[model samples]
Target: MARRGKTAAKSNPSRSDCSSTSNSLSRRPSSGDVKTDLLQALSAIAAQHVNAGSIPLAAALQADLKDVLRRWKQEHASDLQKNDKYVYPLEGRYDAGESSIENVARSSRDPRIDISLEVGNLSGADEAVVRALQSICNELGFAIFLASVERARKTLDEEVLDEAVRLVRVFLLDGGRVAEHVVLSPSEILGLQHLLPRKLIIYEWAAAISALEGQGQEEVPAELSAWIELQLLELFGQVPKLYVEDGPALATVLTPRRLKDIVSVMEKFAGTTPALISFLLAIHSKEMPISEETRQAAFKAVFATMLASFDITQDPKDVRMKANEQPYRPRSLDPPPKPPRIPCLDSDSLVQLTMHVIEDDTLRHELSLFTSQLGAQTTRINPLDFESLFLPFLHSLALKTTITEPHHEDLRTLFATTITAYHDRFVGPTPPIPPSEPDVADGSRRWVRPPVRCTCAANCAPLNAFLADARRHRIEFAVGRQRRAHLHQMLDATPRTECTHRTLRGGSPEALVVTKIDWDAVHKRNVRAAWEGRLKSFGGWMEKLVGAGVDLRAVLGLEEYERVVERREEEAPEEGAKDGRAVAAAAGELRKRKASEALVRSSRLQNAEGAGRDVRRRVAETVAVVDLTDD
Candidate 1:
């Protein structure tokens, strides 16, 4: 019986052995099934931690999840060999209608996984939470970041706003994965505009947009471009206010290209004229980087606006008077007056703006256009406004060293027109010429006194007549002490005259004697010297602006130039003056140098003539000798 049982066992195993074999077969799992099970457990654990506000723990598990996914991908590489499908976790479900197990089985070939979490109240969240959020975002994708931004936008909390800005910046700096995932549409950006804090807009939002545009990842839609334009306009509108609030901070925000972009937008959009002018004016003297093209556009816009707003008939003096008059004050307090329709820039501001316009080489053509237009209206411009605005502008342009040669003709025309319109200011009424000195009978020197007229009621008519006579140099007013004191006061105030108090021999009322010296010549020489100095200084500037080819005297009008510039050459030396002596010495030295130069030239000419004559004679003699040899 035992041998028969052994044979049977060998032929077919017992029930226990069959059960063990079946159990082993049932318990053994395939590699695909093992990967599915591991992913399911990880998803469940991550969900549990997220729900329980254990984000740090969930974030920590991301590494293990990634590892399992990687190994699964490596083992069953063919299974995950489909198009990129994001494994979005929904209650541990992969997608709608698919079980987690089925999705995990499919995910063997899908390497991309994105997790969307709803952790409430991130406003006061700890740094660890933020860090974990960042980690999840980096591992997963931009969907996570978009979800956070939406949450923060809804909350509108300051802390939430900051966190959202920080997250978006970090994501964008990571090469703008969001833009890659989607087109980064304008609607999406515009929707988030309000959520972004103004203080952080330049640093975060603008920087991100700049980066995206710079990368040229995708074509920017028209709507998106328009949206960018509108946002830039709004930001430029706030530039003045921003500068007033925090100038240095605002200065640091803009780069040259960024500023150029803003100005270009302003140029494209109409009715942004005021904002453009204000923005340029506000950033005028700052160290902010601005391109020449931008400055030209801004200045052109400003000039166009100013020309449009100009009223030739409206006198600026009258406007100023009206402005100075106090507004009607009702018994009740009134609202503030509306700002001027045109920007009322002060003289200094206008000067700075003009300088910026003139110094930019690119604006040469535009400047010519503006100056031509300005010159046409020069006569009609209110004198007060011309002096306050245009005159200073011209002065700044004149002084600017960067002005190139191309602008010279326009500047000359503008100056010529201005000089004609405002002749008195440029060339005043002719100054009075000093009278000649009188002939002295005793061979004593004398000078004619300037005429003096007083409205005092006294018998000083004699003294006045004597002072008015050019041939007489001495005058005496003999009167009471009070009258003599009055005469002394008048003579003391008068220029180029000396006064002496003399008591008559018999105590006759004290006499006030006045003698005019040759100080008038000295005074005239000093005035001429100062005028010459100014002319030389102005001539140097003209040389820079108009170049050497264009005659400055013609541009200035010959009469005015000769009076202001050339008159110094014709000045005569005053007698008994050190300045006169110096001038005479200089003239003598100049004449001597000229004479020596002429003598040297004459000597060189004579020596050349003599050598020519000698050469001719030698040649004739050689010809004669050749003829004799032939004979």
Candidate 2:
């Protein structure tokens, strides 16, 4: 869904995508004289970026910026000369004393600093303008910093070989209808990546993303947001060399009192970007060892991060590594842990609750998915597993749906991810399909997808019913690469049971609707074997029995059966009367046979039952087998 470098560019600015990632979403900033506060925040961001990268200036270009400054000063001299007392006051770059950041943190409505300095007292016009210009510079790298300014942009546009300028001036500080600055589009940004330092663009946009995330909006270009988060973490991983060099500046701009809050917020935030997550943790935890509780989580996260990176969760080496690590650690509590719930899920309870899945008409795929994940450890799901797995999965699932709307495409994805997340504790690692592969068939064959969604159709009931049957019957998915190879050695591996149904297709009298056998499994296991040897021409043998004066109509009477079967336009439902038709006919035969006749019939029944359940208990088994249905 997202690539590393390109993500930020693809956040389609045209769509009204919510870009807010406010750390404190519920708490909104109140309206008032927030002018100074807004200015301070803006100034801090601007300074961080301005101080970040190379100020591109060749001898000629340096002279050009100076020339512009000289001309602007000259042009505005009349205005500057007139406003000697109070106009065009050169603002000073903020000097952060020990308590300056602290004081800023505690700022109420009015900031203590005097904003209206006399223009005459203002010493450095170039410096004040440069500092003010930092916000724009932070936004625009110095490589093209002056290109968008009124005079410079006009000059640059004439010779314009470039598709766009790095910065676009929406309006100017000229007191008319002008925007101070606007960021370039992604395409424009990429064009300039080589021209400007990557950090300049990274830090500038990172600050914007961080600030926007603080604004309580969601639904931005997910790829872009995710990329920024990851890159922040990536840079985080490289903390000391790049970021630590700015610690003093950070301390000055952010404040000592704000450290705890910053760290706390970052601790939670870094989880979004694993690249920086480890370093964020290491930076904070370098001095203080992680608590036992946090350690387990850290391991799981790091392990999953590694798995994601290498795509090797199922490797034997990984399993051994996981085995060595402690899986659970108790969290510290004010009081203590609560007593565990009792009345473990009984077989009857699981069965009874499971029936709802088979019978219910109202449940959605989300419910189906959630229910399936909850029972992963035990097909006959423990009710406690519902509380443990599904309940928590539902919470995240709900958050992903409502909070992270665009990401929650399938319910099964939520379920599969939940199962994978807790794989160590709850569902032991089974044959985990790759995160890239489909765990379930979307009902249609697909090679791979994110874990949760398997085969899916519009409706879930039949699928739900099928899964329930698999659960009840203890259908083990062949585990490991050798599972297929091992199948021949397991049990008779031959069909013993009679099928429960005979299915006829819609609009065709001769179509076999349902095989009554797990043909998909059978075909994969050994298709040729099904028709090989003794099982071949079992149909012809059945006809021979009927032709040899063995009155099959007496046992499988054409009258009642014809009347019952003809009463439908479409095929009968699963587990309908037809499901048990083969068994009914076979039983009928047994009942009619006398002891001596039964002994003689044993070999045939035994032979047929051994081939396939469908062959014996269903239409394929019976002498009166119909090739197709007339709808």
Top TM-score hit: 1
Clashing pairs in 1: 80-109
* lDDT of model 1 at position 92: 21
Q: Which ten residues in a row have the lowest lDDT in candidate 1?
A: 1-10
Model 1 Cα shift for residue 631 (angstroms): 87
**Candidate no. 1 TM-score:** 0.29
Candidate 1 Cα outliers beyond 4 Å, as residue runs: 1-365, 376-407, 419-422, 425-427, 431-509, 512-551, 557-631
CA lDDT, every model vs. true structure? 0.41, 0.30
Using all chains and alpha carbons, the TM-scores for the candidates as numbered come to 0.29, 0.18
- Which segments of model 2 are wrong by more than 4 Å? 1-64, 69-191, 194-311, 314-606, 609-631
lDDT of 2 at 508: 26
lDDT of 2: 0.30
After best superposition, candidate 1 residue 583: deviation in angstroms? 34
lDDT by residue (86-202, candidate 2, tens digit) is 011112322223223434454333354222111122223323333333333233222112112110111101211122223322211211223333434322232222222234322
